[model samples]
Target chain A: MAEIARLAGVDTSTVSRALAGSPRVTKETRALIDKIVHETGYVVNETARHLRGGRANQILVIVSDIAAPFYSDVVQGIVETLAERGINVLLGVTLRQAKREAQLAKQLLTGVVDGIITVTGSIPKPVLSMPGFERKVLAISRAVPHEGVTCVTIDNCAATRQVMQHLHQRGHRRIVYIGGPNYSETYRDRRGAYADFMRENGLAELARMRATDSFNDDADSGFHIMKSILNEGDRPTAVFCATDELAIGAMAAARQADQIIPRDISFFGFDDLKLTPLMSPPLSTVSVPRFEMGRRGAEALFRQVYKDAPSSSKVVLDHRLILRDSVATIV
Target chain B: MAEIARLAGVDTSTVSRALAGSPRVTKETRALIDKIVHETGYVVNETARHLRGGRANQILVIVSDIAAPFYSDVVQGIVETLAERGINVLLGVTLRQAKREAQLAKQLLTGVVDGIITVTGSIPKPVLSMPGFERKVLAISRAVPHEGVTCVTIDNCAATRQVMQHLHQRGHRRIVYIGGPNYSETYRDRRGAYADFMRENGLAELARMRATDSFNDDADSGFHIMKSILNEGDRPTAVFCATDELAIGAMAAARQADQIIPRDISFFGFDDLKLTPLMSPPLSTVSVPRFEMGRRGAEALFRQVYKDAPSSSKVVLDHRLILRDSVATIV
Candidate 1:
């Protein structure tokens, strides 16, 4: 550090600030220091720094599927929130698999990181219930049975009911519920809400399709399931999916089968993901506060880690229905 | 561990395996073991483990943007590849800021992890040129000037030429190139190729739209730029964007302007990111081997880290032009 400082004609602290990417130093000064360090082959010895500082200055953020746009927004929120506090982000993706989720949780529980924010529904229940784990954990957009862990989620039932009522008002007589596995709490709550909405409105909930992977991360299952519905059974006037991923698949299948969107059958999705608006006929879906959920999850986790506050609590954010070109008036 | 095992009537190895989420034991056994550990108030003291083990057992993955589908697929590949070797991933987002990239590289260069895989075009040159860093770093889908850094990139010139040839053959004479920044090597290469293709084919290259951010991580720039082109005079018959994100924006702008696609204008994009098919008119794009690039970068990093291989190399993957509804023959 002193050598680079001497070469750049700056103080050691300026070099340190530059090395840490602190905006305190000008870019030109940093570049000069960087050039000196590059030429000198100087390294910071991060292992020694880790030894001196116990916290790792980093957090592990576990997401269900990195490829899914739905989770990426929340991950974005988490990354931005943590970066503000100078804490780095470690990413663990489970592909919505319980084993992978459990493995990630166990590593963190065993102490690789002091804190974790998990956004997967399939995490092993035992990992969540581990003693001392709650103080260092946050659940985002998913429910964990353990009492001490903080969580930020939306009311799935209420959101589903709103979607259902809107579809009913649009004169959709028959609606199919395309969802993931019964094991997923995320899907379970929404499915239950749909059933309740159907019974209350006197609408028959006869058609339901589960995407091939009980978890629905596979993007093509929605299309395949919808195709079968159109081919084998009485067609529902509308279909509501548990996620935008499945609905995208369903919409593609409809397009391939020459079933015009809304004109032939209306489609609805949860999670108004980034690409939903760009769909040929824009998709009408429920918009969950995904980024807010992530930001709040990080905020809650930081409170426990930095301020030593009580960790066990919950915050349910709001959801809105975004009606676009996908749905239509059916006579 | 012994006390928990004895209390649960299981061997200490069972407790160890369960806590590590080995999956050798049944979930029921794991749950029982977890209950015993929770009741016994046992914590695995991760600090001691990290200190004793001497390595963080994780790799840092620096991405251009976490929310973009293109980078996410590559990251997913890297995470999966590393997990197979029992290594974890630490994610750093540059947001296309050179300062942020420098700081991330400086941190990793100093030794937070034994290795880092960076997927960004805006990384500072000094960080890559820093001695001893290349032995522990891999660059994915971006060209770096440092000879020591191993990289996996597609042949941008060849891919762009194919796109230009296809559009020219489709009877489009005036084509607009919607690109990122002149400073960005990724776009510079493709732009150079487009200029070459235009000159060789006796076509004029007049329209060039740089996305709102020269760094191009923000996905909405293409739409904003395309809208301006629509409002102005002498519209090109076709537009080719550097990324699917930009093409998506361009398509939306065209739709809003009541400009029918293919008939009025043709659109082409690079990167066959998932969700391209679901577009109103499925996008025609150049499919870069994003996941493969990520996997190869990790492979290169691990080879150098674990096997003590050489530090520098390059691998150019194939690119495929996918023709879809976005473009059409114009007489």
Candidate 2:
């Protein structure tokens, strides 16, 4: 490091900043440092630096499933946000498996990564017992029960209440709530809000709900669940799904049963997916700021990892109810 | 290691294998080794191992866009395949930006990862010149021009030919081709094949094509392009899109223009996305084994990385043209 600084006629700190791609160095000085480093082949030994207890410059972004449409934007946000800071992201998919989550948590605690940003909602229990884990963990989308980890999420209860109120205002007396797995805190909160609203509004008798099997909230699950509802001969005025995938699947099943959307049944979904607007009737959904959630989660994790910020902060972003053509104004 | 093995009354190699989660160790012995390690607070020194020029056991999976819908299944396959081997996956999204790809390539070459598997189609030039890069790089869905990296992709020419022939067999003369960005080798190959089939069938005059702008192949792009085509008063009997998103978008535009699917125009798309089956008319697309492509690509890279296998192999997987409600059998 001193040799590079002497050759570049700059302070060692400037050389270090330049090497780390810090913006503090001017463009000309950065060019000079790059030239010198290229000529001297002074490769930064990341493994050696990590052995010396320096930052690995990498963090693990763990998700339950990458193939889920909901996560792609969120993961993209984290990757892009962190890349700007010259920090690489290691993606670990748990597939909602306990063993896999435990394995990945071991890697995070064992120094393979600088910290962990879990979008999977729940952190492994064993990870909580690790020393200094509080300083290196952040949760997104779902709040962690532990006081050590910070969480970034939208107000699920508020979002659900808004959806239910909208349905009630539209004169949808019988609204069925099709929830995802109970393991997800987001789903639990939404379901809780739905129950609370129904009871408070004296519509408890019309409060019917069904949930997809654990770890299975995809469109197919929604299709089968909706099929069962249709077969039971109890038609609801509206269906509120925990996810857009579920709503889309329920819509498909309704179409198969010759039920016209909005005319026969209204539908509402969470997570305004990119393809939602392109749907036939343009799905009415709660537009949760997924990308912003990911970006803020990364930023929060960065603050905790580098700036010594408190790790127990909770950040609640804004969400909007997007009423598209899928919902009907019933009298 | 010696203490763990001595305490467990096992060989050091057994202890190492057990620690590495190798399947060769019996369940009883593995449990014993885990107990000893837990009691002794033993943690694997990944950094020290890498400093000794050992395997990092982590590979980078680079993609152009994570939200493209095309990549989620592929990435899932890669993650699952590697996780079974106790290897970790680090995801790097280049977002089709040249600088980001170059930066990620630098990380791969600088020993931060054991190897790299690029689904981005094009590998950075500097990475091609890196020593031993041949043994550490694999390409999926798109072939790298360099001879060093093995590639796993479907035969684009054959797939496109099948789509064109199927359209022709259905007595469609004016089948317009809707392609994606030209930067993608897969898109280029598909377009080239479409041209070849048109000329060979002596329908050159009927061969009209349109493409989305560079790095813009999402549904919105398809919608705008279709709208322009409609404005131009060029009504083709059918449209063959390079991706499912494009097809879905085009279909939406057609619906907006009050054109009934199949009855007014037929549509065909590549990459049978999960939501395709739920479309009102159900999209007819070519089924490219995306998960298999990812799985095979990772396995090929694993062979080169671990077994010193040759890295210049080309593995072409099969593709099927699915005929659903989107296409019409016109007389």
Candidate 3:
């Protein structure tokens, strides 16, 4: 940057601004700076410019699956922000498989990517337990439980608490919680929140209604679980699902059983998937800023790589309550 | 090959068999070959050993949306097959954006991946018109009217003919066809088949309902077009959606309008999405063997990359009609 600035008869800041194609820079100056860059093969220190690693120009954004509905917008956000700094993204999909996650971790050891931001928690615990793993790995919307590794996740516990509050306020004494497996940070937080909140609210009787791994991230799981719940004599006035996929599944089951959403039984869900709006009665969900989460995860990884900054700062993007028709105001 | 055979005290064929992990090769021989490979870093020319790509150990799988539901299984198939050969995959998601596609095309010029297989026709016509692009690209579930490009697609025309035959034989005179953009080969063939098959069957009156984008691909476009058809008088007794997402949107609209699926009217959909079987009444649709399409697409690309074989021959994978409750017997 300093060399380019000297050649262009401009300050280093102006050179930086020009190279970034900043709107503040004059078009002619930007073009001139670009020409000089091409002529000299000037490779910018993208990491330093972005304040991540001192100059490592690379970040690995790991998602469990590229095709899964939960992570596309987040990946899109990460790619968009990184593209400006000439930092390339290498995507790794773990497929929720432990072996694949281990292989990806081994591949990362090759020094191909400067830092890794993983959304999947499928990696073996022993790998993270190994020394020399600090400052290089970050979790996104998932937890690794390591001291040096940071995370950018929604307030899942509070979100679950809010759902219980919503149901309780709506005059629902019995509320069922349908959740995924215990291995995931997402599922753990949600289940813990449900148990704690229900007990705190004096709705201890509702705790027994909770179902685990009832929705293996699928609608059919929700359907079967809902059927089993409805088949029992006592029924909850409202149900809260861990993710929107489970919510949709439960919704399908309710409809199949000739029950109407919010009329007979209110329902709540999380991770407001795009299709949630299109469901028969738009789902009431905790709208996770997945795009922002992805963008921040990418930015954080880049920041650690470019600036050698602190690696322990956890950033929580906002999640909003979308009060769609599915949540009945019974009170 | 000779080196491996000499080192292992085995014939060249035995060495090859052990490396290929053929059942005929004893476990001891396979273990011996593996140890030698570990010692020598002996890279397998997967293409040649498989009698496909003699030396190409890289495969490129391009998707319209790396996150879309449509391409997930296809990618899984490609990854599983290629991983078995110790082949590396370079995944490029175009996001259905033309500018990005052009940029990715330039990167493709670097000869990084051994073979290129795209889910749809992503590269612009002008981009493909450029020299040196003729021999490498293959279209999966799509057709490109270009020489040298291999196409691995489902028999869309025949499949559509079967759909129309099923609907017509069910005593339904009026039929509707909802499709996608004009550039998509899958949509084009389905629409063309709808028209030709309708004309041949003397159902010209119902052939008036055809929808397509001017120059872009979007499922919402299909939903709006289907809405217009529904609003008009004398609605079709049966409807055929080119893809499942479009069908889903159409179904939502029908549900909103109090029209019961297959009870008030019949609907046939394509691409049997994972969510389809879980949909209310389970969508009556044709299931395209996407995994096979992807596996074969990579297989064809490797064949070209290693042997310099001209694979202009289009391969058609299987498509089966799943008789779910969505399409009622109209008698």
Candidate 4:
């Protein structure tokens, strides 16, 4: 650091900041410092510099599956935010594979990133036990047992409870809950909330007909899940899905079976995506704070990456229930 | 390189392969080579290495928008293919913003990536004229007038004509065509096909009902566009949309207006997305070989990047039309 500073005729701090691509330094001076480093074959050891400066320019993001549409927006938000700060982001998708998750954790032993943000629940304790993870990891949309790992997510249980409450208020006693695979954090949150809300409201009889988690948010999957329920010949008056895609699928199946939405049966969905409103009977859904989640998640990572400041233990955002034409009063 | 080989008591080529993280190299040798490089402050100049090997390990991919769902599969294919060859991918999304597109072109000027693949239309000729024109470059889903630029796309014009023939065979005369914005190569192909098909078939009167370019594949956008046509007291017995999202929206609008599918009006869509089958009345549309297109596009870029082959001028893939419940014979 002192050698570069002496060669560039600047203070060691200015040299450090310039090399770090800090905007506070004049562009011309930064260029001069960069040129000197290039000419002299001088390369700053990023790991060592990070240790000395107590800050890092890297953020790690772990997602359950990169292919899933639900995570795309959230990942975009984090990437855009961190990119602005000149911080590099390392993304890992577990694909909901436990072995892959373990491998991803082992890979993180490279210690390339300063902090970690995970959207998956199954974070292995062995990875966090690494010496570098004292204060640099946060989880989003999932919970971690480690007190060191803070989380940013919506109140999934509360939101699903509200969905049940809304359905009840609309005079729907017989309501079906369409859930995804058991491994997902969202499935657990929503299912737990549904059971609690139903029991508390004395609607346990209505909760007896639960659709198994097989289908994703796609219509084909939703159709089959809805079909099995309808095939039982004990039709629910309304259906609540863990995700909007599932709701759409179920709606298609109902229509195919000649059951009308909001007329013969009502539907409620989660994560009100752009396509939700375009459905024939505009779907009613809980709008996950997608844009905000993106903004906050990224902002949180950047704060740690740049300022070396510890983040809030947990950051919870608000989710809104959007009432559309999919639900109706069962007079 | 010779120093590492001497230290490890191995051949220079063995040392080089180990340092490059080649799986062919023994794990012990690879680790030893990495340690030697770290200890000696050795930096591998990628450009110089590529110059000797006649191949580069980096690829640049430019797309119109990353937020859309269509490109995810394409990216996934490219990533998978590149990961196998130990090549790194630099993804750039233009977001339909011209400045960002130009900026991305500038980034390519530094020769950071060995080859380029673009889904965006005509890169300003000046941008392509940049210094590193000798490496590989392919355009996906677009045609550009560059000597070395290869184009990989579906035969859009033929595909459109096929759809029209299907509707015609179903005995539909009053058919309206929905197209995309004028800026894209895709719109040009489909629109040109529509014009020629109508003229040849003596359906010139019906061709005038082409929907405005602003109607992107959104449900509301399609709904409003369809509503305007219906409000004008001019209704097409059949509608052919350029994209499936638009067709879904148009169908939603027709339903909102109390029009029955096939019974009152029939619809056809392009791009047989997964949702098409799940639609209330499954959409009848043409299916683009999406996974194949993605695979071919990546393979083309990789071949050019590694072989320095004169970009094969163009590659066109096959497409098929799917018949579903959305269209019916004019009864």
What TM-score does chain B get in every candidate?
Answer: 0.82, 0.90, 0.78, 0.83
Q: Highest DockQ, which number?
A: 2
The digit string of per-residue lDDT tens for model 2 on A216-309 reads 9999999999999999887998999999999989998998899989899999999999999888778999998988998999998998898898
Candidate 1 lDDT over B234-292, as tens digits, reads 88899998888888888888988888887899999999877777676788999988888
- Ranking of predictions according to TM-score: 2, 1, 4, 3
The DockQ value obtained for model 4 is 0.19
DockQ for each numbered candidate? 0.42, 0.69, 0.15, 0.19
Compared with the real two-chain complex, what DockQ does model 2 have? Answer: 0.69
- Alpha-carbon runs more than 4 Å astray in model 4: A1-67, A86-94, A98-117, A122-129, A134-138, A209-217, B1-58, B110-113, B122-127, B209-217, B307-310
Q: Can you write out model 4's per-residue Cα lDDT over A32-57, one digit (the tens) per residue?
A: 99999777656454334444554445
Candidate 3 i-RMS (Å)? 9.3
Each predicted model: what fraction of the native A–B Cα contacts (within 8 Å) does it retain? 0.66, 0.73, 0.16, 0.16
Which of candidates 1 and 4 reaches a greater lDDT? 1
TM-score of each: 0.84, 0.91, 0.79, 0.82
Q: Is the docking of candidate 4 incorrect, acceptable, medium or high quality?
A: incorrect
> Per-model TM-score of chain A alone?
0.82, 0.90, 0.79, 0.82
User: Which CAPRI category fits model 3?
Assistant: incorrect
- The C-alpha lDDT values of all candidates are 0.80, 0.88, 0.73, 0.73
Single out the weakest 10-residue window by summed lDDT for candidate 2 chain B. B45-54
Fnat computed for model 2: 0.73
Task: Name the better of 1 and 3 by TM-score.
Answer: 1
Which residue pairs does candidate 2 place in steric collision? none
Better of 2 and 3 by lDDT: 2
